[model samples]
Target: MLLSAAARRRTPCPGGALLVVGDSPRVVVVGGGPGGYEAALVASQLGASVTVVERDGVGGSAVLTDVVPSKTLIATAEVMTLVDGSVELGVRFPGGAGAPTDPGLDRPGGAVTVDLGRVNERVRQLAAAQSGDVRERLRGEGVRVLSGTGRLAAPDRVVVDPADASADGPADGPADGSAGEELAADVVLVATGSYPRTLPDAEPDGERILTWKQLYRLQELPERLVVVGSGVTGAEFASAYDALGSDVVLVSSRDRVLPGEDVDAAEVIEDVFRRRGMTVLSRSRAQEVKRVGDGVVVALADGRTVEGSHCLLAVGSIPSTAGIGLEEAGVQLSESGHVEVDRVSRTSVRGVYAAGDCTGVLPLASVAAMQGRTAMRHALGDAVQPLKLRTVAANVFTAPEIATVGWSQAQIESGEAQGEVVKLPLVGNARAKMQGIHDGFVKLFCRTGSGTVIGGVVVAPRASELIFPVALAVEHRLTVDQVAQAYSVYPSLSGSLTEAARRLHKAPSVAG
Candidate 1:
């Protein structure tokens, strides 16, 4: 709801009391994840007194467990992949086993190895430092940082429980709860993130059976890791572990891996997975997973069985909304338990906004941050733009990464989007050839008549970095001629994007 300056409600300033005129808005942000903290910063910048309440940590699961830790571990695995290819790159370990890392260069069964303990230690430290940085930054911005679970007492009132001994967030209060503090708010933001989706039959033991969150606790890599679910999360871990010398078997309920991603890109990744010795079990579903003695066993719905030293569950995530006072406060929740928020991030209840996974929007940190800023802008009566999922770029960090933006090929095929598609294999790129990379492609989608860039996909070693230009074109509605006119570095993978655009210089009569 946009309001004029004269009609906007008075909010809290630096002073204690919240009810008054000609002051900042009292913004209480619940959950200190990307959505919460980013909203807090925006609220502060918009002349609002902000407070962040979190029980996990300032960075929430995105930092503490899920995104940061998994990506950091993947980084180590990526380094291992690079080192394993050192010999092909004209570099070799001198005298074989003389190097440090306890026979790192020459493992009995592998060419390169990673120390899971040391790698996880680094992951933990980096995540903690990142969380600390957020706390310090928020405090510097004069935003009150409360380490506790926040509950909505009313639409305009938030009560914070002083963190107990079990919480792992920054300490802004005593460990033991002596009492609770309540704050009046002109606007409230709920950014409580989601947790790993689990099933009754497939429980994580944090040892042999584990969720993605429990992967970093391992001191030794799984000799045979069976990963259930072939979605983005499963594919990523399967690719990472395969690169890091694990015998990986990926189980997919769908006929192909990455069923949600680009079909061509999924094919490339699946082929690469097979070529790299990782088993791909398509059209297979695991009914239950259980620990049997030292190893874990996964029973298939088809009466088949898969045994592995460890199992990683990467099915999906559930919103962390239960028993959080949202329903009690009259904030309407979806059947899936996600908060129902409009594009502007406003919940059903006025003065209450939701962002991040809780809102059931695109589950990306970048999307969360954007939703957060947009929510604050709307709440504070500032000029704002609603969240645009079309302009958002998404990347799957596999060996040959897959990055995509805007309208997809499937959308175009289904007539949901009108566009012309041009696909150029990265195997033909000069840089890919020079780097000994043989897989991946660059596919571009543009409006048929005007040649306005609509969408694109990149599959390469670092496709994440390469998708930005395409995303920029799609977001700003740049023409193919404009993108082609722009110079990409010669002998580069990015050149393929422009090359694909150059091929689409004129609207095609049909798909080519």
Candidate 2:
């Protein structure tokens, strides 16, 4: 049966090409995060009128609160770590004529103190600038930007409530009207994103107890910091603060930190954390957190307590799907409250789609953007390939970062995948030797029959950047031999990746 133009817009396109529609469809995207904004852009490019309703600033948590702020803080910590290692490279900070000289680089008498106030100011400034940039870019793309809270009034309509006195007023509709405006959209994309999950007993006061968002408010550095939950966020902060000279403790309910990551990578990070004076409390869970006098205490489930100047809860995140009229609008949500989305980012309801952390998909910013683009392409009568998770690359941004792409070692061990594993230690790489880095490796997985690169893990400084080639290889189905034959800079960290692929190509195949 031939479908109407409107019906065709709601239908998913099979091929990866834009479907030229007779009429421009109206697209409404809620939330200004990477997922929301990217979807808006794609919809606009596909000849649809797009409006983005953003409650917070543009760029969402990944840019304004979570990813950008944390990574900036880590950059400062990395500088300190590099300075501490300068003595090994024959670099010397000479003492004053009458001052006593330090014997080792690690024990430099010149004490370095972090100016938390300055660091936080810079972080906020950077976040704000980036948010502004995103907003400007959206405007440049002819996407109508609405600064308000948007909720589904119906499958084809969105009601936007004006933001409070804090924001720059409503971006559309009457400025003085009490009743908000309602927009009729042919397609609605929900990308409201997620918020940091906190326990009822461990509420963040923003002073003593902090969420990742509130950490920037501190004027003074924490003398002792305790991080709850050993996930990516917790591990990153713990590692950064420790490097910044804080006495840090990381509490984990799992047997090890980053339990969901590559096992070898997680083990190496835990070892590095402990070796650098961090207290790793494995198999420990925080039952409650309370302010005691001038300090904070985290009571464990086993009747033990850990005290620190401040406590940070990194337990996890909850999708921001509540009170948004999603369920009432016939959008299916998972048991955990995340929007249930298919490969092409469609919701259960026609013309309604979801993306980002709100969909319970991979919580990375890159994944969020891809899902958003996919949702737009599918909803705006454009052809789109379904999202493929096998090629997604994720990184833990701790010092000497851990990055992994595609199939994991656990998959092979569980007989879920058939592959051969090959590893190359960074210590053997000339660049690593020159940089005095000894504790990292690159591991690659290849198919048994065709030597196709399936997955890989990289552990080293800037592993995030080093994993890109491997990610591309997996996404394009490039074979191990092809990767090995690719040219790489001599004496560079990437050589280790090529070397691992070369070894995988030469290794004998094992049956699944």
Candidate 3:
């Protein structure tokens, strides 16, 4: 229900007279992910006393396990893949055995083994260090770091359960009990992020069968890895592990890999995966995963079983939005269990807001940060506008890294956007040839009549970074001729973007 001007005027701030008379209100944020931490900082800057309650470390799963660690591991994998290609580049080792083995690169079957023990240790260390930095920064900004889980006892009150071990006199346990501290606040920010989703039948054992979280725990690489799900997460791990020397089989329920991404970009990666000896299983649904002797068996819906030494399920993630008083607070949730919030992140319940993956907005850190900031602006009586999805840029971190921003060809063809698509292959680029990279393209979609760029796709090494200019063009309604005029380096891969735009300007028309 939308509030009327009279209702808004009568809504009382938690601080009562002090808040009404222009005193800063106390704002409590639960969860320390990007959304939570960013909101805490913003609220404190706006002169609100802020407290962040976190069960896990401050950076949440994004920094602690998912994005940072996975990207770092990908970096290592990239280096190894490049080194493996050295033989073709005339970089030879004596006796054809490659260079003298670095103990770090040595793994079973003469492949580069990621020392997961060292990797996990390093990942945790980095996450912890980053978390500490966030905590200190929040403290500097006058936001209290409350280390515990937070529960909303009332619409205007939150209760924090402190670490259990602190009161138990340090026995085998950390601490035992406390009544818990209650905090009264004007506005509550719920940014508790998500976790890896698992199935009851294919539950992870943290050993042979695992989720993305348990990947860093291993000391040795698997002999063979079978990845279930063909979405972004599944594709990323499959690509990374294949590069890391695991004989990988990626099972996809869709006709192609990365169903959510640009169809052409997904096809390119799928083709590359096939060429690299990673088995691609399309339209295969894994019904269950059971542990067999020394290996895991994946039962498909078709009565066929695929056995591998290890199985990693990457179906998707469920929002972390239960048992935190959302229902009691009357916050509306979607049918899929996502918190239903406006573009500015206000929940159905007054004085409550949500951001990040919980709201089921685009699951990007950038989106989370934007939603959090917008929520605070709306709640604090600042001039606010609802979010515009048109400007969002997203990237899939894969071997070639698929990045996209505005209009999509499929959408245009389906009459969603009456646009023309111009695709430019990387083989025509001088730089791609010089770099020994030949597989990728730059694709641009624009309103045929107006010549304004509406969407674009970049499929190349560092495509994530290169797609931004195109994204900006789409967001700002820049024309193909305008983009073509911009100075791209003489011999760079990014030149393909401008060239693609130039080509789109030359195109007469598209069916749409």
lDDT of 1 by residue, 388-432 (tens): 899999999998899999999999999998899999997788888
Model 1, residue 47: distance off in Å is: 1.0
lDDT against true structure, model 3: 0.79
The candidate with the higher lDDT, 1 or 3, is: 1
Candidate 1's clash total is 0
| Tens digits of per-residue lDDT for model 2, 1-512 | 32345564443345332333555677889888999999999988888888888776678778888888889999998887776666666665665122223321253334556898998888888888888788888889988887778889888789988764422111222222232778888789999999889988998988889898889878888999999999999999998998888899999999999999999999999988887779999999899999998899999999999999999999999999999899999999999999998999888888888999999989989999999999888766566789999999999988789999999989998899999898888889999888878688999999988999999999998899999999999999999999999999998999998888777766566999
Candidates ranked, most accurate by TM-score first:
2, 1, 3
- Those runs of model 3 whose alpha carbons end farther than 4 Å from true positions after fitting are 1-20, 94-113, 162-179, 506-512
Candidate 1 lDDT = 0.84
Once fitted onto the true fold, the runs of candidate 2 whose alpha carbons sit more than 4 angstroms away are: 1-23, 94-110, 164-179, 507-512
Judging by lDDT, tell me the better candidate of 2 and 3.
Answer: 2
**Residue-wise C-alpha lDDT for candidate 3, range 1-512, written one tens digit per residue:** 32223432334433221132244677889887888988898888878878888766676777776777778777777766665555544465544555435321222334444665676667656666776777778878988877677788876788886643321011111111233778877789899877788877998988899888778777678889999999999998898888877899999989999999888899999998887789999999999999998899999999998999999989999998888788887788888789888877988777888999988888888888888887777776666668888778888878878988887889999998899998989989999877667578989888978999998889987888998898789778999999999999989998988888888776566888
> What TM-score quantifies how close candidate 2 is to the native fold?
0.91
